[model samples]
Structures are given as structure tokens and as C-alpha cells.
Target: MASQWHSLVSQKIFLARNLLGQLENSNSVPAKEALLQGTIELGLRARKLVLIMIARMYQHQHSQPDSLEALGELIGTHSPEIAELNQLASDGRSWWNHLEQLERHQGNPPMARKTVSSENVIAVAADTGPDRSKQALETTLGAMKHFIDILEDRHSEW
Candidate 1:
């Protein structure tokens, strides 16, 4: 279960970075359009996975009929061992929520911050906001991966 969360985070972060890379090398409008749509959608899906995992981790399972019962069943049989996983779930949920809010801004912002004159072609890509967002997303995902690893490694305890 933990590994599942980590893998989802890594995939989404990778997509975001790839999109940022495409933007950096954007030479045509068609390519730019494709990357933008792909990256944002992938990011949203990844964010959704984080939410699902967290919901499964700590939410009490009750035998209510219909969809809510199905959700409970997906978490599997709960035990005292699950208590340790709650902290990881809480942290992951907080980070994912922040990422979702950041994503609501829509398409990537312009990368050229200092380049005023187009003739010089002096566009600096280092200060790009998209890159910062990518890095932040990756960092959060990496944290999630680490947490998952810690649990999976201690499978005996779980």
C-alpha cells in the first residue's frame, strides 16, 4: 500500500518536470500546447492518488451499505499496526492539498523574467516559476516515497 502511494507521487512529479522541460525548449505552438495539457492533467491525477491513500489510511471502517462501504473495504482489514501509518497519511494529505491549490492557477507562467530585449535572446530559464513548482512537487513526492519505504521495509511490524 505504501509503495503504491510512493510510485504514484513519483510518476506525477516526473510528468510535471517533463512538461517544464518541454516549455523550456518550446520551439512551436503545437508542442507547447501538447505538453501543457499533458502535464497539468497528470499532476491532477497524481494529486488524487495521494488523497485516496490518505483516506484509506486513517478513516474508520464501518459496514455501511453502498459506495462508502466499498471505500472501507478497499483499505483492507484494519489493525493496531495501522496506527503508525497515520502520521504519514496526515503529512501526505497536507502536501497533496497544497499542490492541488497550486495547480488551480492553470497553465505555466512565462519563463523569461529578465530578458527584455528579444534581439539579445538572453532568456534565463533558471528563474522560471514552473521549474520551482516542479521542484516543490518532486520534493513532496520524494518525501511520500520515503515514508512508504519506511513502512514497507518494516513490513514485519505492520
Candidate 2:
């Protein structure tokens, strides 16, 4: 289970970075649109995986519907590391929520097949607020990395 969680985090990180690379190199409007959608999808997936990692580390199963909140409560009882982890989890949640909003605004739920115009695609691609940037994605990934480290360090206890 731990290995599976780690693999999920790694895969999501790779997908996010790969989408960013494609976004960077994209020239045509349609290509950029597609890549931007891909980035949002990756961000959302990353957020889910991060929460799942935290949940699995503390609890044997990731069945908690609101794992982020549960993570806060669990980690809150820890040492001084709570502050940093809380901040990361908060940022991760906020950005993930924003990405979800963007997805809804695009009328394209994750893994949904729908035909959208280039203009509509551009609009969704440009849906950037403070929370929906590359930095947010990076922050979320960093938090996941920290969670992984903490779990690995205390694996014997678990």
C-alpha cells in the first residue's frame, strides 16, 4: 500500500510536470488548450493523491471522505511539524478546489469526453486566479514529498 501510494504521487508529479512542458512548447491555440486542460487534470489528480498519502500513512485506509481535514486533526497532535504541514495541506486544498472550479467552469469533468471549441478552451485555460498557478501545484507536490519523508522516517512505528 505504501509503495502504491508513493507510485501514485510520483506518477502525478510526472504528469503535472509533463503537462507543463507541453504547455510551454505549445504554439497553436488548440494545442495550448489541450495542454492546459491536461495540466488542470494533473493538478486535480495530484491533490487527490496527496490527501490519500497522508490518510494512508496515519490510518490504514484512505476511506475518509474528507481526508485533508482528517489529516489536519491527526497531524495537529504532532510536534512542531504541524505548522508547516498545515500550511502545505491548506495550500494544497485551496489550489485543488480552485482547479476543480476551473474544471466545472470548463464544463469538462475529469475523464469526460465532450467537444469544446478553441475559444471555450482558451477561456478555461486562462482561468487563473491566485490559487490556480504553477506555484500552487509545486506547493502541493512539496507537501506530498514532506508527507512521504515523514512516513518513511517512522515506518517502523507504523
The clash count of every prediction, one per candidate, is 0, 0
Candidate 2: TM-score? 0.57
**Off by more than 4 A, model 1:** 59-98, 101-103, 107-158
What does the lDDT come to for candidate 2? 0.60
Model 2, residue 152: displacement in angstroms? 4.0
Worst 10 residues of 2 by lDDT: 123-132
Top-lDDT structure, candidate number: 2
Q: What is the lDDT of residue 60 in candidate 2?
A: 44
Give the per-residue lDDT of model 1 (tens digit) for 35-149. 7656666766665554454443444333222222343455543633334434333553444444444464454564445546668776455532333344565565555456455
The lDDT of each candidate is 0.52, 0.60
* Candidate 2 residue-wise lDDT, 14-113, digit = tens: 7876776666577898987786667667766765665566566656484543445565675454634345445654663644445556656566444644
